[model samples]
Target chain A: MATARAADEAPAPAAPAFDVKNAFRNICGFCHEDYGRKQGKGPQLMDNPNSDDYLFNRIRNGKPGRMAAFGGAFTDDQIREIVVFIRKLKPNENP
Target chain B: MKRHSRKAITTASVAVLAGLAFGAQANEGILKRSANDWPSYHGDYKSWHYSDLNQINAGNVGKLTEAWSHVASRATRGLQGFPLAVDGVLYYSSPYNQVYALDGATGQMLWTYKQKLNEDLVAKQTHSPYNRGIAVGFGNVYMGTLDGKLVAIDAKTGKLNWETKLVNSEKLTVGFTGAPLLVKDKIIIGSQGGEWPWRGPIFGVDAKSGKEAWKFFVVGGNEGTASDRRDTWGGDSWKTGGGGGWMPGSYDADTDTVWWGTGNPAPLYDWAGDEWMTKGPRPGINLYTSSVILLNPDTGELKGYHQVLPHDAWDYDPASGELMLIEQGGKKYVVHPTKAGFVFVFDRTGKPVNVYKGVDNINFVQDIKPDGTLVGRRDMKEGKHGNLCPAIAGGYSWNSGAYSPKTGLLYKVGFEWCMDLEVVKTTPILEPMAQLNIGANFTFQPPKDGPARGHIRARDPVSGKVKWEMKFKVPPHGGLMATGGNLLFIPEADGWFSAVDAATGKVLWRHNNGQGHNGGTITYMAKGKQYVATVTGFGSLVGDAYGELWGEPWVSMPKDAGVLKVFALK
Candidate 1:
């Protein structure tokens, strides 16, 4: 096996503030359809009955076999932003 | 060091003799495909998915009854692997790299082997756990694992002989869900890719020693690749251009070439519109991705290639379909179905012979000419676009169709669906473990002509003329099998396994396996008796949409369950 690359060991550069809408469209929207306003492969995030803590944990550590864990891809703050985005989701009246 | 060299020489001598004996059998078994064995993933190198065993014909197919059943453990996304039979023993794989050897006639479990996997990585993956199939050759069963390793187990003892890590799955977040194709002395396997932002690679490994011999990247050509070919991807976009030969393609022994179809580039939906040639997440045609490539099995060298969809922005992968080798009027042709609802016919030299629509819902392009040029491109911008024909699930998903030499027709499935998309521009994530770079949010919808549905069509593969078709409310997401008995075995997405008369699309026998079918089916002779075997289960990425698109059975179907159902004349 090859040794770990120096790039991997080096400290990660500071990233821009997470954009929940774009991120959701890129990743989460694969299963959660309509920007989470309607259900598709996953449950609709709009008007969700789950609590903040539930959403946060689920996003970080996903349900096995049901959803992929995004914790490695997203920070805690980013996941919280996603939870907030879910809370604010509403039907696109114009769309 | 001197003593070690002496021992290595001794081992090499023994391996060569064993290889000589095994290579002869493997070549004959795979190239000709004995009536008693379903040796390769495509049944044979022709990718016919057909068996010549005719004990159970259409006249007596009604007398067929369940011989036995084996429920596989940890069938996470249902049993999605094709079962291979050799002699009287049956070998198959399930989720989590679980391999099982069974008595093909009795379903008696002989032994089971499960690979130790990196559970954490599997949990973070969108496509995980399930193993599509296994290849048996040289007295070992070879399977590619979810944790980026190709493992070979003793076909008899079910013990590990060797395990070689081929990919950095912990970092790339994708591994092998497809089966490895055993060609000659090498095990050829491709990694899972498409949305992940990394160069998808297909590896050629030494079958005897489990050592990686060579690797070829499908996204961008390797160092040995021509400079002009490597320049197909603009700038550094090729560095993370997602493409993979995710499925097991067939071989043309006459030409001594292995044909493989590659996945689409990453960030599936490009928002560059018509400026895609010089702008977007990845500019240029993205060379080998979304194309049919021919490789030399011995050297892993690119022999020839045809880019089916140049600058494939719609995520329509040719990788999902089977590379069927057919001959007509002394001309050899390769019939490949692209996920974008079109079937591309290519000659032995990788030149387009013809291009035709497999599904009616396509509007991604006004037409793909016989010369393989895109006309009237509907490149979407960074906004909402309606009626994107053939939803993300694709017109043709990963499951394969069967071609019958007897009927001279191809039996395949075509999905009818569309989607409304909202393309978003996002940065490619590659550092802390790769993530899906879909670049779009879409909802599944019915096509303009009808409700979202599927159908089975018997057509002239080269000419694209439909002889007959059978429609379904929802597409069956399983591999098809045709037999010399003049029967077509279809594993339905709604839990019904039916045998239809190949001559006339009439259902002769039906059995409910109690779950949706999304894997493979084949017919083989075990203990001098003809038997049909199919893996039953559902919950594939494509089938996952069924719960929301349709109600009832799909919503209630268990995603983590599967059964290997076998049948024979009672």
Candidate 2:
């Protein structure tokens, strides 16, 4: 649950932390795994860190009817870290 | 590994363990028989449609033509329930609870078992529809009615052996939609009420005497705990929870256990009651819904459990596809493809070693833990709707999936799609009350970009990696089979039959079967030659919303599209 924020308190800024292989794993379950559509227990992700609104709300609030929530277990800054990582995710020439 | 990427790799050992425990053999195409036999619905309980016959390889498949086709008497309003082939005799069930016995060699009807559908009984049922298929064991054929009655017929003669009513269709509107899976002497079946407020369960009946053997519920109610899911809603959705084992279960003879997945929780659209599902993983992993549940064939004991969809609010039921068993490098495993667009590999212990997201365009959760437990985002946990990755129907739906031992690859088919689903509560409920099922207008939404089409690919089940990939303009559906001739037989929804190179994932040959396929494809050796068969008819969730999502062309009229096309190698 999002608590009422004070004027002094604001959402944390994004962190520079990122998994080095972010892009290669952007569509981690891509290609042959599900013939591409078999997303398994989890849905696919984007490489574009700019896909954050779609990412945070998806990861923080959780997309209903499809995904569940995780904001409580994870800190807003930690989530932003993931969003940053996703934005830079790009497939290398070969994994 | 990617930070948020869910690992879909399960070591071969885990798959074998899950396979042994569930009594389902490796789906590596080992337990596969000649395509002609169609011995088991999934060809010998293992659910692997792999055939040894190489006559119809890519080399000769181009010359292949449809030898014969048997169209259904009436257009199928919603045809699900696959057929059973034994000793060249094909036994199939049609909508309205009708069963037909056919000759596998020639698409000829040898006998027909019209269930004398009790319209009055069905009318009273929440969603009285028809039979899925039947099981043949102990010299008798077992079939369940849309109204929840289990009937046993003699194998040789179309005579009724015994009948047992499993559920009162009026009170539950729950019945069997999956073909009866025969394990040793027991005929295992499940009921359908996913769309309704009926209890979820898989029922086992004595194959010989038609006696009630055991019943394993997907949702818990008997324990009498409000915290227990079955008591949550305290209403029909709570009571019904739609545990229909809509898809046939896979049995591993070695394990003596049955591996089956459960359907979606009821109340169709609104999953307010299925709270846990809205959260990370629903409580109890919904017992059986979207879970790989193990049942003791003899006692029907629920030995172990693993959930594929926790608190399934999106209707991404794991009940559709088949459970394939594979053994890699001496490690055995249970291979399963879910409607949620996942190609999951689990250890024999039912532990999630790895889970990989295959869909390129889903937007639900970010990842899965090493234990196979799902980690949901905080916001999406509660029953609400938005840009859920898979539109409940998931990356893949009620079609078949396959594996080729020769290449050690798994093949899954489907349209990569998602939607903006908003679960609004329905008032007064729709009639005839739809057999106490849940109701949801699963609105169709395409991916952020690209055409709304599907594809089929050959995958490395072990690493959750892709070996080769191919695309289809129309959404793809059905199971796939790889053969000795280095070919993959794929039935498509684009009215074409195809053969792809087993190793490279190349589309080597194609045939216009004339219609899209719904069920999986199977191959066998008949008359010293190899022949392939696929069931082309729509059923399950698609039939429920055929008109809305599929539109007019792919639409289903009360009875419009139903046919079984059998092809042979010259």
lDDT string for model 1 (B432-474, tens) is: 8888889898999999998999999999999999999999998
Supply every candidate's count of residue pairs whose N, Cα or C atoms clash at under 3 angstroms.
1, 82
| Candidate 2 structure quality by residue, lDDT tens digits, A16-39 | 443323211222221111211222
Worst 10 residues of 2 chain B by lDDT: B1-10
Reference-based TM-score, model 1: 0.94
Tens digits of lDDT, candidate 2, B1-570: 011122222243234322221123222222344344565666666666666567777677777777777766543433455566655666676666667777777877777766655554444332335345666555556678766778766555565656788876645545665687877657788777566545667888776567788877776533443223443332233444566777687877677778887777654344344343322112223445556788788876767877776556666778877787778889878887777777777887677777777677666656665566667632232233555666656787766777777778887776666765433333212223333323332235667767566777677887778877787766665556667778887776556778888888777788876656666566655445556776675533343333444565554333346677778755
List the lowest-lDDT window of 10 residues for candidate 1 chain B: B1-10
TM-score of chain B of each: 0.96, 0.84
Candidates in order: C-alpha RMSD to true structure:
4.9, 16.0
TM-score for each model: 0.94, 0.74
The local distance difference test score of each candidate is 0.85, 0.58
